[model samples]
Target: MSSENDWNEDLFDCTNDCGTCFYGFCCAPCLFGSNAEKISEKNCCLMCCLYLVLSGVYLCWVPHYFERQKLREKYKLKSNPSCGDCPTTLLCSPCALCQEAREISSRENVRRIDFNGDNNQPVVSQPEATSDEVNHVDMRV
Candidate 1:
């Protein structure tokens, strides 16, 4: 088995994805619910309501901490020593949610296709190759 890996995104790297950062900051409960649902297939509405109720009483970070823990275990990610899960959720809830959202989205196999106006067809472009990468072809004569 391979060793555990660090989080795909850094906690302070919230600005990396503008949309997720905005969503996390603007509506934490919705983002938390979405992350919970994605991680455990839980009901988004129920999770959202739970987060809302918890936030009302000033215990909003509890669910996010648990969800973050779950995400770490599921992905075999290393734990943060400087800022633990509970503290991260408690102190930087929006950023934590943004990180989780970024992590989850990064793992999903989403592809973007562009439309060609000339032929009216969808074009799937390959990633640009780096200098170190070699294009191998088998020649049959």
Candidate 2:
């Protein structure tokens, strides 16, 4: 009589076991573990594709479990301490969700530099008078 939440918890546990899991993308532990054969194809297929893609990338490019762990740990350390306001904290750090949120906030704060006259400030340019022209003008004055 396990609920969907129970299944999700099992999936998270299995994914966390290897330290290189795709978060909740893999099959539930109840399905992929010792009792794997009893699980349904629908549940397995729903989770497998995303996990396979992530695992493939991790195995090919990342290669080192320790390296990935280090990256995850570093992000956790650097992430904002106040999780009360940020819903993305649930995803932890170095994750796509957290990175995307950070990128958006950063972009929002960035100021656009204006080189043309469109900005509110007045544009100032030096008068193109040569030194001789300035001297002659001064003498005439």
Candidate 3:
């Protein structure tokens, strides 16, 4: 059974290929004992231990973090006219028009929306609206 200090030492050694190292020399004995082969496969070390600890912490705290991120993003509103500038705002949302526009923008067939062109419009389409909503319709006609 290796101690944490021994695992740390083994992990820091550049000579060993992590893929081939055994859990007994790489991970804490208690953790290795429960899942020896699995730990050995991953070459578990101080970094892996830290990653697991951090992931556990993240799992416990992610919901709150995500909620805060949502609020922050909402408050930090901007008229980002470029898909490249605001990828998260464009991609994550459930807007069909935005999805289609993204698809079009990706294609070589479609003309690129030049950011510095006379009309600095985003390639993304306007949000969908009901039949009565004329504001949603493009005025190109």
Scored against the true structure, residue 139 in model 2 reaches a CA lDDT of 100
Please list the residue runs of candidate 3 whose C-alpha ends up more than 4 Å from where it truly belongs after superposition.
1-51, 55-59, 62-71, 74-113, 121-141
Better lDDT candidate (1, 3): 1
Which candidate tops lDDT? Answer: 1
Model 1 accuracy (lDDT, Cα):
0.87
Instruction: Give the per-residue lDDT of model 1 (tens digit) for 28-131.
Output: 99999999999988999999999999999889899888989899988899899988998899999989899999998887633244578999688777898664
Candidate 1's TM-score reads 0.75
Candidate 3, after superposition: displacement of residue 57 in Å?
6.1
| Index of the highest-TM-score prediction | 1
With candidate 1 superimposed using the best TM-score fit, by how many Å does residue 123's alpha carbon deviate from the native?
14
| All-Cα superposition RMSD per candidate | 12.2, 19.5, 23.7
Model 1 C-alpha RMSD vs. true structure (Å) is 12.2
lDDT of 3 by residue, 20-132 (tens): 23332343222322232221233435434543464454441232223223332433422224432234322332121122222222332334554545677665667878765
Q: For candidate 2, which ten residues in a row score worst on lDDT?
A: 3-12
For candidate 3, what is the total of clashing residue pairs?
0
Better of 1 and 2 by TM-score: 1
Backbone clash numbers for all candidates listed: 0, 0, 0
TM-score of each: 0.75, 0.19, 0.16
The local distance difference test score of each candidate is 0.87, 0.32, 0.32
